[model samples]
Target chain A: MNRVKSKYLKGKEKFAIGIDLGGTNIKIALVSKAGAIRNYLKIPTNTQQGKEATITRIKQGIYQIISQSNLETRSISGIGIGAPGPLDFQKGIIHFAPNLPGWEEVPLAEIIKEEFKIAVKVENDANVAAWGEKTFGIAQGVDELVCLTLGTGIGGGLIIGGKIYHGKNNVAGEAGHIVVNKDGPLCNCGNFGCLEAYSSASGIKNRVSRRIKELKISDPSIFYQNNFDQISLVKIFEQAREGNPIVKDIVEEAIEYLGIGITTLVNLLNPEMVVLVGGITNEGDKLLNPVKDIVFHRAMRYHVADLKIVFGKLGEYAGVAGAAALLWDFD
Target chain B: MNRVKSKYLKGKEKFAIGIDLGGTNIKIALVSKAGAIRNYLKIPTNTQQGKEATITRIKQGIYQIISQSNLETRSISGIGIGAPGPLDFQKGIIHFAPNLPGWEEVPLAEIIKEEFKIAVKVENDANVAAWGEKTFGIAQGVDELVCLTLGTGIGGGLIIGGKIYHGKNNVAGEAGHIVVNKDGPLCNCGNFGCLEAYSSASGIKNRVSRRIKELKISDPSIFYQNNFDQISLVKIFEQAREGNPIVKDIVEEAIEYLGIGITTLVNLLNPEMVVLVGGITNEGDKLLNPVKDIVFHRAMRYHVADLKIVFGKLGEYAGVAGAAALLWDFD
Candidate 1:
């Protein structure tokens, strides 16, 4: 199987590489025009070691993925790296990524392209992931779509007419930062009442923790006692499934805020499909049903009639697949 | 001069006829591919006579324009009409136009096309005006743009990748209805604190009137006494220009809210250009400067840098010009 895959990759003329630089790990993959993962490699980001080392490690991971494939370096078309931002995509530099420590305006794309002799495109990780979803996941056939990644901080991407709408300065699709509640909690973006403040994983966790602390509830302190050791969304989903009111309440609030955020996008963009991706979306219809219901009720009737809200299907491979899809466009 | 203009218009095979159906008047024009208005005519809408009479008046206007033009109906590619909504663009019907009394689902386009034996396309006035801006006005050459028409109600249009993004249904660009303040004011759309309630022409007039009534100030009841006299935005601009404290306060507050609304679009669409058209934008730099300052300060910095906000240069002719531009494409 490995030999067949390797042989198939060897014949490609415009292969591309996708590197998903996350906080904890660097995931590199060799992508083909067919949206196939020719080869892939993963390594620790070691963000604590600072920016230089992190870039070096990412470079090495790229090399490892390339070395595993029989493809020639000359035939490689481009390299797409998806990293956490504030980023200057036009300059191919990272501005300041909280996940990647000591990373400050690192011209990672330029360095990689220079060393590897391939074209490089850098985008916000969420944007790239959305590209992946649009190209290979549930958003495959849709032209106008908005993908929301509900993780630590909510990330969004706008895909219009089958291509990414990066806005004026590659900063479009900051849907999470849109104000949902003007008087709600303060968001990390230094704004009051952003959707991210209420709907993201950390947002929900914060809400749950605050409620727990305020009520002085005596239940499983599994999350607090060990610094949320086992209090993940998965466990919370289970609690909600088993009819725990506290867990249900927290989820409900998150979904409510999320609905408002979605409604705002619906009114603004009028996208045909809104794909919800990320770890939290794993709650499936439990989260999606309420969100759809609220958004429909809140949105104008004309805007809601044809709107579709669905969970992403690509799962963990979206980043790499999106990166690979970038190569397909060149072909 | 008429002969010379007729000769120029005759040379074009791809000419479109655009009709801007207004409350009091109907403006008709012949548009060239280069976004030029070859010729135009204005006729009374005569809405008090009812829908059939209004449609007849529109047909007469179309006939007059076509008959006077040297260009043949065969050479005229298509007819595009921009009118008040709610509309069913697909069916080429007007749903409910507040300006046109007893107007509901009037198949204005279909009837016109059948009468003239020409193809007709109909869109909401705001959407067509937005198209005009995108195709020929301040947003010319920009593929992705958003236009805000500050009239009785705030009407907006989104051109995504050069095509109008009409949302899931045909109600995209309802930016006016988007709630900005939860506790602000009651909007006619049954929402509280919508951007329209604070920033539109009527909204501004309403605010000013309410303030006067509340304070029992002895200003002329121009707003209340003469309903049909038309509370001109020019009057307010003049007052603001002269430093009338109350007028200044109202304009500034409206500017602030307008900034908030624009910032929301900047964060959401991130289009290459945002064109502000309508009477309110006539405040020009007074409104533009404050809006730019607030949007830049509040929006994600990356999104702000490349955004260009400019006033519409086409003036009152934009609706007809845009409708004409549609002919450029369809022709």
Candidate 2:
């Protein structure tokens, strides 16, 4: 038999290259079919070096991972990338992400495929994370799943009937934009009263900054610093745990709005599991318990009966893992 | 070949029996494969007379339609039922419905199949309506569809990836209960500020009545009557069109909230079309225009780019047509 016939005939060529392209860092990994990270590497993106340099760096990273792991290039099942988007997955184009400045319709997949002489796939960052969780993390074996990446801004990913549901135009799963309060506050998406405005990290900090001014609590050293811009989520949570009044209400409201937003998702999608990922998940049970209580209490009775709301097990590796999984069949 | 061998050997055996179970009436029809209603039957439910009577009436109606249409029992595809839910579409059991009193775990499909000796399917009413629209009505050929039944209550049916999405347990499409204004008004589902409270027929009437009491508009004959309970939606819309204060704000708010609720759905589900159905559709452009305006301007740009927001074309026959379509494989 020819080498091409051994693609899966021998059934041991079970590795894939996964790449997570972030504004600050690029994470690349050599992952096995069973989801083990055989080799991993992280490098600074240094986006200021421009798109070409970033592309060159990614190619170098891919080579480094393969060589360090001592794996043959043919034994690998190509490369998969997860990046910030409004990008086209089918075309593998980056259609100008907010964080990835100057990236306008760059076909990253084609570039990588040309270098590697193998398959290459690219997906939205949030979707990649959700896929990672569904494939090998907390949501393993769960068909209907929702993954929320709560970082600087909230992002949502949906898995329906065990398949990634990239709406009609690949623009579905805008869960963070669900309007929880129709007239509450402005969101980054230019809408008012979005769930993101109330629950996201940026929104929480902005709320605190605005509330500090509105309430005229200038001496905010109890929780925040003299500089409103210096207010970190960690300090805010610490103060809330200590019952510092300035931070308590804001933290509690964030939790409440997050709960309400999640309840809306639970009611709408009726997913088997909701996996929480990103910075906000670090708060752990403090953030998760109340959100669960509200969803269980507020969502339709049948939806909550067997539903699970938990943190994603993959953590930072989700982007890399899920991106790599793009080349693998879901089974 | 025996008679059974002709199931699909001859495509001419294309008739299906459809039964729409409602609080006021049971609509039964003999529908052909080409979306034509060969014979239609309507009967008053007289729900006060109880379940057995209703089921018998349904059976009698089915027999009448088949006889009237001159369709042979063997030629008919099967029987399909559309009923108020949370019903088990798979097991064909109705857990209970708010309108269908005392219908506890009724094995509707099993009961029908036992008598008829053919395939029988029971589905949630909203799902049936959505399926009907997808199969033979306004949403024909539209893959991602959202159908709204706007009557005493607002109901939602979803067609995701071209099939009716029943969520995890078939209790998925409760569009009416979407909490638009988290603090708006009390809904029948024991929730506050649900879209149903702001947009449903009963909710609209209730809002006007409460506003009359709150604002002390005792002389409501300019639109509503002295008997606050008789404040009909038709009168309310007419007065609102004429710019009457008592009815104008309430009507405008209803449309606005409905728009906002739908905008939320568009953002989340990214449906290609949203078909509005039921009594409120009588207002036509007056209702469709403002709702469309809000959704178009407020939802994510890509979601609205090619989205079609139109009135359901099936009219009163939607329930019957949709229920009947359950026995046919969706193209």
Candidate 3:
């Protein structure tokens, strides 16, 4: 949120426009080469307005940030976008995104480039978040790392050899789909016992809701008038801490499964660190400590020797900042 | 098994000694720069005689292989040993292998180097197998791959960017320990529901033995006159195919869990290929077809788009050849 320029950006100033295109909102920021945000703007995606309107909204968000900074598009290094994936990063096309409906093979980069006459790079949200963490956040200078976005659904970004590891088909880091309990609940992806099925915000809430009904708990005050969907994970975690029966078991299991999934990743990849980000991280140490304990205890002795499991430092700015960071080289 | 030297191994022939130090035996080979085994030797390890005796045995095997090839130790490029892990590749120390009891932090590389005055590298067996597949076996030319050794126990070796990825602690490719059926069975590793507990040779045989007793099937010929340990996995698979009740469910579940484990790997790493090796691979297409079907159908569409799940080409030579392969560069 700081507009203060870094003293290290002493020479001819460089800036890049970062766009975090989400299902609910479009976040745009004018970021310096040093990862400082000079101008920021947020606007509703209104996907109900259709793809063209959403694109227009993104353009407006970009234009709004640029105008706020009083900088010409030509002066910027480039525009980088972090969008929901199944993306063709090489071609700058989004093949399909789970969150965004009616978005199929959208040439986001080309459309944005045509409007601004600047080079554009589109990356997966998870990958961008990872890049953001690697470039400027907690995992900075971490060569081998896995950054997880723990929100409505879990997403993973793998940094192998200090670069985003895009698998053969550009959808490599799908950590959420990792089967923790093969006999566990079904995931949104139709896979049974995925990490997302156990630990994601939706997964936790789904179970909590089911358990609440099963136990016939009619406590409205405990659930904030039962508007559970609008409720924060922090509240649920607090309830678990306070010994609410339904929330406690469900939350403990979710955290345990999260730890198991992370343990699986650590065993397989043997990363130097794991950065946890997104909404669920709002629980902070309550989430990280337990997950860390599980991973540290369960993973092989050698793997956890120097493995650091912690939270992402960039917070909400990771997406926009990381998307923008894709344009600059990390020294 | 072919003693035929590659015609291209011309001019100045370079060789490296590969030692596969197993619990029961020490297999050593003189391998050429082109990944051809010029000479091979295998002798009993006799761990009961102590670690020093086993080391002497390894040395004898190496000497025999060198004598068979008529090559001086000085002429060898280097020696690479692929042994049961928790190995320190940098220091060439075996950090207490599970199979080879009493082999605790033995500096095998230093001991051998002092004796032979040649560079020595010690790597985890799984990693060597993976490197072997990538360098000279079925996964040759594949940059991203996961090589699985399904023998007495399941082991995984990952080849990322055409090199063995020794996670943070040189124990990264512990794919056998990946919890597939989290609620399934207890693993020898003290973990529950590991891939090894479900699909490894010992795992399958143990379940078969227990099931045979439980089912009260007194068919002596079906299990080779109650000598289950001496039986091959091919026999069990055949019995399963023949619709033998006790063997059928256990065998199917074993294959299914193996498929699930492979599917987990495919989903997590998004590797280009998966190579299956070791004793259990004797079932060949019977195993490969079912695994391929499961992975292709279960894993993400993009991941399975061009994924190749196949068997290792080096057969039993994979361990020795792969260990030797660690000494050379594949161009």
Task: Return the lDDT, model 1, position A257.
Answer: 76
lDDT score, candidate 3 = 0.84
lDDT of 3 by residue, B145-260 (tens): 99998989988998887788887677888888887765667788776778898899989887887777787777646665356447557777888999987688888888888887
Worst 10 residues of 1 chain A by lDDT: A1-10
lDDT of 2 by residue, B109-128 (tens): 99989878888999988888
Model 3 misplaced stretches (Cα beyond 4 Å): A1-13, A72-74, A209-239, A242-247, B1-10, B209-235
Q: Estimate each model's TM-score.
A: 0.83, 0.94, 0.91
Candidate 1, residues B163-217: lDDT per residue as tens digits?
Answer: 8877556777888876676556788766567788889998988888777768788
Winning model by DockQ = 2
Q: RMSD, model 2, all Cα superposed?
A: 3.7
So what's the TM-score on candidate 1?
0.83
Misplaced by over 4 Å in model 2 are: A1-13, A213-230, B1-13, B221-229
Candidates ranked, most accurate by TM-score first: 2, 3, 1
lDDT of 2 by residue, A44-82 (tens): 999999889999999999989877766667788889999
- The lDDT for every candidate, in the order shown, is 0.78, 0.86, 0.84
Summing lDDT over every window of 10 consecutive residues in candidate 3 chain B, give the lowest-scoring window: B1-10
lDDT of 1 by residue, A1-331 (tens): 0223445545544578888889887888887766777787888888889888988898787777777775567656778888887787777898888787788878977898889887888888888888998887888778778999888899898887677877666677888887766567777776667788888887777777777778788876544435545457666667666878777776776788788778778877778899898888878788899999877877766677788999888777788778656655631
Q: How many pairs of residues collide in each model?
A: 4, 0, 0
lDDT for A53 (candidate 1): 90
Best by lDDT: 2
- Window of ten residues with lowest summed lDDT in model 1 chain B: B1-10
* Per-model root-mean-square deviation over C-alphas: 4.8, 3.7, 3.7
